[model samples]
Target: MTNNDPKTQYNGIILLTSYLQRVFVAETIYQRVKKGHLGIRYSEAKALLDETYTILPVVEKTKQLSVAQKAQLQLITEKTLALMKGYFKQMPLSFNDKLALVGSSLYGEQMMNNGVIRLGKLFNVEVNKDFHMRTQFYEDRTKMVDFLVNSIHHNEQPDVNLVKPIETWVVDILRQKDYVLADMNKISEMIGF
Candidate 1:
């Protein structure tokens, strides 16, 4: 969808943020391996995607992730986002530069598969081929992280039960904000600068 469309725009941001979150999770695993928490190499993370995919419900498939999955997902997403935030803090980079840097790694594939590029399209961000190659690092990155951290926070609380599919949370948030039209301007405002 075009970036001017509010529905598409907001959803795009959500998707992009979500993909970034997943990439963040994979990056965490990579760090873990670097720190000796896990012995696997960065190249092997893609295999874990199936495991994460398994945790998702059958009927809803990708969009209708359960509350537990959402929580687990959010944890990894938040942690990864924080890590990226910190990384950016240590060495300043614009969004494009950051995308290029991390996108060059193995994990970028997972971000792409999980809709990173698609989300970027929503925002009119142009990520290149080298950025695309990094998904391999992120394939299982989302799931492996959720599985590891889920045990600690799975039962703590529940996500808001929005009637629609989980993918539509951005739309839901927009709707909640009274941006009924939800076009590109509204979405851009909702996401802020």
Candidate 2:
């Protein structure tokens, strides 16, 4: 019963998900789904999306959905948000706060993009997304980092205290020997979403 891969994947997925939930206030399920950063399974996505809506109180506001569909959404959102927020509370950072910080850093354009970039590199392959290519990850990372470094160089910002550390942290974690690579199903289980 060698479940290391699954376990690691699950852990990574949880880490990644926690990162996103902390970074941004997913206004809608579509926002979460379109991320493509997790490479999560549909079931996992469905579960997590459902969970997020609980605290947000916005997931239930869809305009053209059936009552049954809406009800299901409410349940999932509440349950998932509860579990994730609770499970990862002991970290130096709260999931939502970290997510908010990341969201704020990118000025809303590339939310969680830094983490995705690092994950893509650690996986040694192109992430599963149509918007950004494998090479784009490197280019984007370098451009973003270079921009930050140069900002400090010019004293334009005087310091790169915003996202550089998060980018570094992501890269370091992905490189850890015990780090897990996640798939969707396991991710769903970890969050209980």
The TM-score values for the models, in the order shown, are: 0.29, 0.25
- What candidate 2 gets wrong by more than 4 Å, as runs, is 1-46, 49-63, 91-164, 167-193
Question: Which RMSD values do the candidates have, in order?
Answer: 17.0, 17.4
Q: Which candidate's lDDT is highest? A: 2
lDDT of each: 0.37, 0.39
Candidate 2 lDDT at 138 equals 45
Q: Per-residue alpha-carbon lDDT of model 1 for 1-193, expressed as tens digits?
A: 4433443433434433433433444445344322334423222322334433444333123433344644454443344333333322223433222222332222333533445465455446676765477565465433433443343234332223321222243234324333212222332333322
Model 1 earns a TM-score of: 0.29
Model 1 scores worst on lDDT over the 10 consecutive residues at 158-167
Q: Give the backbone clash total of model 1.
A: 15
